[model samples]
Target chain A: MDLHAMDRYIKSLIKEAGHKIRNSFLSDISIESKSDANDLVTNIDKEIEQFFISRINRDFPGHRIFGEEGFGDRIEDQNGVIWLLDPIDGTMNFVHQKRNFAISLGIYEDGVGKLGYIYDVVNDDLYHGVQGGGAYYNDERLRPLGITTIEESILAMNATWAVPNRHFDHNGTLKLIQDVRGIRSYGSAALELAYLASGRIDAYISMRLSPWDIAGGMVIAREVGAIATNFRGEPGNLLEQDTFLVANPSIHSRILKDYIRQK
Target chain B: MDLHAMDRYIKSLIKEAGHKIRNSFLSDISIESKSDANDLVTNIDKEIEQFFISRINRDFPGHRIFGEEGFGDRIEDQNGVIWLLDPIDGTMNFVHQKRNFAISLGIYEDGVGKLGYIYDVVNDDLYHGVQGGGAYYNDERLRPLGITTIEESILAMNATWAVPNRHFDHNGTLKLIQDVRGIRSYGSAALELAYLASGRIDAYISMRLSPWDIAGGMVIAREVGAIATNFRGEPGNLLEQDTFLVANPSIHSRILKDYIRQK
Candidate 1:
């Protein structure tokens, strides 16, 4: 595969998708409830997903796709080349705030991530990484994350996870909140991970996230020395929804062992 | 007092201060801890405060200044025209993220909010309001908040407030977190309030915030029909630090009665 040519083509496609999203903000948005009232999907979300699927199929015939909007292929096994796409990551933010959402995409070969991209559509920030190459925030190269104690770190996660839930113990999550310097929730997992790679934040945690949500982020974060794992300190599942913790290598394990207690 | 003229003058001063803050990002920043390690103050913060103080003192000699850096007058009472200034709200974000911080300034006449301004320096978004005049986000007039129930609203607050704390019961806060559509924490009280005024967020809560921390936001929020009060449902203290709850008028009382339990 011509990785360089593919990277250039994918960047242009993501930018064009972003342009479509920006244009949608001017028109009326049709929204619907997904699993719950808070779990929302808009017309633009489905439209953007279809936009990517059509282009990818035309350019790469043999490659398969796994997408958030269910507009792509169903993979029974990790084989050949696969593109994971989340056309609109934070649909709630898109419907409520008209910002804080992004388009996330990742390319993997036989389950190995090779290229990743996350575009903040509203802010025009494109964070992308090539495996074995460095991560870049827009035109600037991202520096590898440095050591930082949990006491001095800023952690980002949804406030919902800290409430009483069956996924993990609320007490441990609350304790972690108190121990950290501060907490932030941007409502988008992909953008939070991009922030981690750019050193805007130290760590990001999510109780339940799908593969498309974290696949692109994992590739970018790993290039900058961030560790991605489930609560059990294992590589997160790339094919199933699971708990996710991506953080600077210095504090990842400490947070998992001392704070995250999964039920 | 001609509020119209004062509004115009204050707007210029805030823009100048914001310009200075953006310039500071290119230079070296010296950071120090205030009350604790997490409570940070940077040289740029002090510089910005002094910058505003010098201009206000020179232009409006009769007005008293209350600032976060203690570089202004020792305000004893709300008698004359007073300028409440935070110079740089979210100083930690300033030193760490290089964004999400703002210049918050509020002008009051005999304890009555007259004018307010919150400048998001990095984004160039200026939110302001005049007494009896509508609020604005940049050039667009902000619409008054419409009704929203607790279950369909988004709440913005620090996650630490949900942990065991002396100011309020953690259980009630946790319950509120579960009931809301979502929760957000942007690390800047002023920007968060600006967001509330613009309808980007439905409510904002803080356990301990000083007058400067919320003075500007209160003016803007109130102009948009949001209610501002302490946990006890009284007008928040304007001269001291206290718990704060600013929400859309529709759900403000319900939240206070059922979810906010002060201890």
Candidate 2:
């Protein structure tokens, strides 16, 4: 598929969705819990997800979707064109802080990511990428990520990695926590991945994330020469949830082999 | 002695210092490690700290300075005029992100906080508080913090608390992390406190902080009726380093007794 036209259409749709969200932010909107009280979803989240899914269904029929709100189709495999959508990536941040949330979307073709977008709705910034056509923020073409050691790199990860946990070897991740220059957790996975592309954060690692949580970010991170892979160094699971580590080219191998990869 | 005059002078100093930083950013500025490579202090941080201390000493001759750099006086007591300053509150963020750091300053007279200031140098927004006059963000008077529960509250804390650690009961903190409406870690203690005062975040916790780290923020947090106390629910250490917990009034006692209070 020719990406130029697709990219333009996606961008317009994203901006439209963002405008809708910005307007609702000032009005009366109800918020509800998803799986738990800590997991939040606003009326806008449902509306936006439905809006995107409906648009895709109208524009490109039979294209599958894997969305946070269950508005998308039942995606079985990464067989064909699948659009992964996280209408509001950081719902808790959106519902509570009223800032720091974003709309995340990614397009994959034949089991491979082709394009991605992460829009910071409040700030009106857009990060987008085509598989081979380097990432761009607004109109500026992003340069490849710079190389740095973990000690010199500012990681966009929570301090929780420094503690013991059931998922990863807590002790090893903790060592990485102390070995790095600093750690940060911005509460938005999409924004964090976008930052990785922008070189604001050298690397981002999370123990577990769903497909919608990272689809858009994975494409953008790759455009700037960053690598996105699961803990086992396999290509990330687009059909299922798994651990993720996105980092600069130089540090990805080191982080996976030295710290995050199991002993 | 008048807080209004002191606040005006401090604000001006902060603006001028910010101007100097803005002018010098990425222009022959030197940066080096303070403790580790990740902990950076640019020539700007040192220069800014020195500049603030010199101005304070000249304007208020007998005032004691407690600042990030060693230029501040060795403050041994809370008596008399004590100025706490963090030249660059999020030094790493300033060095890396160039957008999130701020200049944080707080003043206490005779063990009573009389004034506080947090300047987002890059954005040119200032949060100041004069005792009994109410907290102000930029120029708007801040409303009193609302009473809220841990389950319903948003917490601004590093992600490490969600995982197990030795400093405090990590498991207990993790429970609080899961119980709260949301969790955030912005990497700047001062701005986090300002947000707490303005009710953006209901609570903030950290394992260790210096007198200069939170001195000004403690005052601002207090004015909004938020509880600014150490983890033990004792008075925050005025002379030495200690764990800090500042939260909304309704949740402070519960957090202390439930999560932090040692058996």
Candidate 3:
């Protein structure tokens, strides 16, 4: 596949979808609850997801889409050229914050990530990566992840880690938090990944994320020499959802082996 | 006092300081260790603080200056017009993230906050508030915060809460985390406050923050009917360093009275 042509096409499509989202902002947003009361989905979310799905079906009929809104094919497996998309990664942030949310899309062929794209709609910052071409924020080439220890690294972990919860041993995560230089948690997983690719945050850890959540970020991060996998240091389950740790390659294994444990 | 004049002047000063920070990016940053091995102090931080101090003193010598760097006066009491300056509110973010940091400054007279400013130094976005006049983002005038409850509100919290650690009761904070619609932490107090003022995030909570940390944010937050206080639901100690919890007035008392407690 001509990766450059694919990248350009994806970027143009994401930009078009972003324009639709921006226009929807001026109109009234009728929000709805899904799965749970706290888990929300707005009309615009469904609209944008459908827009992308239809376009992809027309452009690349062979492409399989795994999207948040059930607008695409049922993707139970990571086979073929799968496009995992989160039209709006931080839905809460987008619905309320009106900024910081992003469009996240990752293309994986034969269960291996081939490319990733995360476009921060409002800022117009497009972070993209092809398997070997490396990541780019806009047109500038991104450098590989810098070497840094946990003591010197700034991490992006939500404050939820410091509090007790069910996913992981909250205590263990908090201990890791104190050990790091600092901590941050932006509501959007996609933008957080863009930041990690840009080396703004040395590492990112999140539990209970779907494949679409980390797909785009992981690809871009890998381009910058960052490593991403499940907590157990095994290959991330492309089909089953689970806890995740994406960090500087040097720190990934140690953090997984030393700190992370399943509850 | 001509608050309008003061506001204009301070805005210009902040923009100038922000410009200096922007230009610093073009050159090599000479960094040094401060309080700890990982803790950093950049020449740009010092230069910016010094620039604000010199400008304020030259025009208003009778006024006192309380800055992060020692360049500002040794402020004991808020007797006369005092400028509380944090040249870089999220210094760690500035040094490591190179983004998500801001220049925060708050002007108080006889212990009453008169004006507040938090400028996203990299993006050139400025949040400003005068006591009576409403808050603003760049040039857009802000409105008073609409009342919101815990369940409906989006919270900006450090991500460590889900894990266990010192400071607050991890479990209780978790309950607080679940009680909110969503949680976010940007790693910058000033930007968080600006978000609060802009009605992006409904509230903000931090374990331990100094005077300069929340001073500017408090002013802008106040203009939008957001309450600025400590965890005790009382007037926050302006002179003494303390933890910060600034939120919409409707919910500030509830969080302080029910959740946050002294260790």
Candidate 4:
């Protein structure tokens, strides 16, 4: 596959999707609950997902699509070329704040990530990476993440994860919160990972996230020397929901070993 | 005192200060630690404070200034007309993220908040309120905060406050975190308050915040029918640092009564 041509096509497609999202803000948005009240889905989300699916199918007839909105194929395996898409990553923020949400998309070939793109729609920042080509934030090239100690790092994660939950020991997460210089929660996993690539933040932790939520981010973060893994220090699952930790390479293992204790 | 005229003048001064802050992003900034390593102050912060001080001293000679950088008068009481200023709220974010920081300024007359301003420099969003008039985000008027339940609200606070600390029982905070739909930490008290006033967020809590950090936000929040008080249920102290809770009036008392236990 000509990855260069595909990269250019995806960038333009994401930008077009972002434009539609911006226009949605001026119109009435219909919202619905997904798994629960907190798990929301809006008309805009489904619309944007369908928009991408239609375009991708027309432009690249051979590429298989896996999407959060279920508008794409149901794949039993990560074979051939697959496009992972999260049309709107932070639906809660979209419904309430009308900001802090993004379009996260990633492309993989036989389970190997080749290109990633996360467009911060509100901020108009597009973060993309092409495997060995490195990452770029908008027009500027992002620098490789340098060494950072936990004591001097800013960690981003949902505050819910630090409270008592079924996923892990809350005490361990609480202790990690105190050990870091500061904590931030932007309500979007994709944006948090994009921020890590650009050095705006050092690490991100999530108790539960889907493949589409981290696919684009993982590709961009890897180019900046960041690491992505489950709590068990294994590669992130691209076909299932799981706990995730993406951080600067300097402190990823330390956080995983000392602070992540599964219940 | 003609508050109308003062409000107009202050608006222009804040915009000018915001312009200066935007310029500082292009120049080299010297950073230093205050109180602790995480507590940071930058050359741009001091410069911005001095710039506001000089202008205020020249324009309104009778008004006393209470600022974060200690460049203004030593305020002994909330008497006469006073200008409370935090030239750069969220100095750490200013140094690290170059965004999410704001210029917060509040004017009070005989202990009564009269006018408030919070300028999000990078985004060019100016939030202000005139006592008895109304609050505004830029040109649009902000509506009074409608009722919201704890289960359906978004709470903004420093995540550290939910960890074991000297200020209060961490358990109460943890319970509150679980009850809320979401929690956000933008690292700027002024911006958080501005967000609350605009209904972007429903509640805000801080274990320790000074007058300058909240002076402007209180004025704006009050106009939108939000309540601001210390953990003990008294008015927020203007003369010293104290625990603070500012929330939509509907859930303010509930959170204070059930979820804020002083250790």
Candidate 5:
């Protein structure tokens, strides 16, 4: 398979999708709640998703697509050359703030991630990685992550994690918040993971995240020596939404074993 | 007092300071811990503070300055015209991430805020407000904050607030976390308040923040019809560090009454 040619094609597609999404911001958008009021989905999201699906189908005839807006194929397995896409992650931020959202895509072959791209549409930051080749933030190649202990690290976690919730025990997460040097929550998982890869943040933990939310990030993060796992310290499920914790290599085990308790 | 001329002068001075601060990012920065390992102060921070102090002292003599770096006046009371300055509000972010910090300054007359500015240096966003004049995000005037219920509001708060801490009861903060639509922590109090003023986030809560940290934000927030108060619903202290809660007027009392309990 010509990986370099495919990567270049995907990057151009992502940039085009990003431009379309940004252009939509200039017009009025209709927003609706999915499961709950806080769970928002905008028309622009669907438009962008369909844009990617159309391009992928037209360009790559045999390739499969799994997209957040359900505009792609329904494949239960992560088969050959499957593309995972979240056209606009952080829809709430997009609808409300018109910022902090990204166009995220991950390409996999036989369930193995081959290439990934995440574009912060507003900030104009594009983070992409190839399997053997290194990751790049914009045009600069990202260096491997250095080791950082829990006490010296800053964590990116939602404030709701420490409160009473159905997902995990609050006590352990509470203790984790105290031990870390600082905590940040940018409301966008894709950007948060990109921040992890860029060393802007050391770790990120979220209770429930979909495949597209972390697909591109996981590939880029792995290139920078960061580890992505569920709270149980296992590899993330590529087919469904699940709990996620991505951290620097040195502190990943310590955080999962000591601070995360699955209820 | 020529308030308009002073406002214009301070605005220019802040932009100049922002340029200097941004330029320093290309060079090596010397960092030192303040109260603890996580509490950092950089040479650039001190230099920037001195820069503001010198500009204020030279440009507007007899105007008292209450600055974070101790290069300003040590006045016992907030009498006459006083400028409250936090040269670099998010010093940790500046030292580590090279972004997300702001230059915060609030000008007051006999303890009453007359003008305020929060310069997001990296983003080039300047949020400013004048007494009896409307607030602005860059050149555009900010709209007055509309009512938002707690269920629909996003709270900007530190994750540590929900865990056991020295200031407030964690249990109540935990419940508050669950009650809001979402939560965000930007690591810069001034920018957090600017976010509130710009309608990006609905509220901001911090356990202990100095006068300079929230001084500029308080003025801007008030101009947009938001309310700034302590956990007990009193006005925030202008002379010292104190607990702070600045929120949309609709939900400020509800959060203070239902979620915050001082221990």
Candidate 6:
């Protein structure tokens, strides 16, 4: 398979989908909650997912697509030539703020990530990576991650993790919050990972996230030498929702061992 | 005093300052530490503060200026006409991320805020307000804030507040984090208040902020019917650094009374 041609084709398709999503902001947004009030799904989210599925099926008939919004084909495993898509990551931000949202896509061949793309719709920033070819933030090749300790690092962890909850032990998470230089939460897992890859922030932690939410980011982040793993310091499960910790390699092990207590 | 004229003048000055700051990113940044390694001050910050002080002094004589970089006039009191300037509110973000920073300025006459402006440099979003006249994001007038309960609101509080700290009691802050719908930390107090005024977020709480950081945001936020006060529920002091909480009126008192315990 021609990896260069596939990468070029995927980038164009993501941009096209992003433009359509941007145009939708001009009109009224039909919003509905899913699972909970905070979990929002808009009409545009479904439409964008459908758009990607149609394009992929028409252009590459042999590939399988797994997407959020339930508009694409369903698969139990990360099989050959699988396309994982999140039409709108940070849907709540999109529904309310009209910014800070992105279109995330990851293309894996034989269960190995070959290419990834995350497009910040409002900022027009496109962060992409071709495995072993290095990551690029809109044509500027991102440098590999540098070593940084937790005390000097700025982390992106949601504050909810610091409070007692069913997901994990809150005591360890609270201690981690005090140990880091600072904290940030953009409400988008994909964008947080993009930031980690770019070295804008040193680490990111989330208790629960699905494959579509992190697939694209995982690919881009790995190219820049950032580490991604579940709470147990094991490899991330690509086919299911799980706790995640992605960070600069130097501090990743320390955090997992000292500040993470599984509930 | 002609607030209308001053508002117009300050708007143009902020836009000019913002444009200059955006240009500075094209050149190399000379950075230095202030109180600690994390507290960064850049050459551009001093230059921009000097630029504002010069313009204000030249255009509006007899006015005093209090700025973050010490290039402005020495201000001891909130007496007489005064301009509180933070050339770059989030200097760390300015030197590191090149975004999420703002040009914050508030003009007060004899201790009363007459006009305020917070310009988001990268996004080109200018949040300004004329006391009694109204608040605005660019030319659009902002509507008065509606009521929101703590459970349904999104609060922008830094995660540091939730950990055991010297400033405030962590247990209460941790509970607040759990009760709220979500929390966000943008790393810029000026932009956080701007977001609160725009209704993008519901509340903002900062344990330690200087007069320059909160002055512009206080004026803009108050115009949109949000309450601005110290953590103790008293009005924010314009002469010194203090803890601050700005929010939609409904939840402001509840958060202040129940959650914030100054240690």
lDDT of 1 by residue, A188-211 (tens): 999999989988899999988999
Residue-level lDDT of model 3, residues A1-263, one tens digit each, is 66788888998999999999999989999899898877788999999999998999999989899988888888777778999999998888888878889999999999988999999999999999899888999979999987888888878876655555676776677678778887888888888889988988888888868888889888899999998888777667766577788998778777887678678
lDDT of 5 by residue, A32-139 (tens): 998998999988999988988888899999999999989898869977888999999888888767899898889889988889888999989999988878889997
Model 3 chain A poorest 10 in a row by lDDT: A158-167
Instruction: Give the per-residue lDDT of model 4 (tens digit) for B1-263.
Output: 79889888888888888898898878899999999989999888898899999998998899899999999999989989999999999987888788989999999989999999999999999999999999999969999999899998999987887788776888999999988988999999999999999998999999999999999999999999999999999998788899899999999999999999997
Q: After superposition, how far is residue B154 of candidate 5 from its true place, in Å?
A: 0.7
Candidate 5, residue B152: lDDT: 87
Model 5 has an lDDT value of 0.90
User: Candidate 3 vs candidate 5: which has greater TM-score?
Assistant: 5
In TM-score terms, which candidate is top?
1
Model 3: runs farther than 4 Å from truth?
B160-168
How far residue A258's Cα lies from its native spot in candidate 4, in Å, is 1.8
Candidate 3: Cα lDDT at A91: 87
* lDDT tens digits by residue: candidate 6, B1-263: 78878777888888888889998978999999899877889999999999998988899899999999888877888789999999999987886678899999998888898888999999899999888988999879999998889987889988878878777788999888878877888999999999999998999998989999988888999999999999878898988889999999899999988888888
For candidate 2, write residues B1-263 as lDDT tens digits: 98777777888888999999888875986778777655678888889999988888888999998888778888888889888888999988887888788888888887888888888888787888888888888889888887688889988887655445556667777667667776777889988988888888999988878877788888778888989888877877768888899999999989888877432
Query: What is the C-alpha lDDT profile of model 4 across A1-263, one tens digit per residue?
Result: 88889888888989999999999988999989998878989999999999999998998898999999998999889899999999999888888798999999999999999999999998899999999999999968899998889998999988887778776898998899999988999899999999899998899999899999999999999998999999999999889999899999999999999999997
Predicted model 3 interface RMSD: 2.3
User: Pick by DockQ: which candidate is best?
Assistant: 5
Order of the predicted models by DockQ, top scorer first: 5, 1, 4, 6, 3, 2
Candidate 3 vs 6: which has more lDDT: 6
* Residue clash pairs of candidate 2: A159-B160, A160-B159, A160-B160, A181-B38, B106-B216
List-wise, what DockQ does each model earn? 0.84, 0.45, 0.66, 0.78, 0.88, 0.73
Runs with alpha carbons beyond 4 Å of true place in candidate 5 = none
The better-scoring model by TM-score among 3 and 6 is: 3
Off by over 4 Å in 1: none
**Quality of model 6 by C-alpha lDDT:** 0.89
Tens-digit lDDT string for candidate 6 (A184-242): 99999999989988999989999999988888899999999999999988887878899
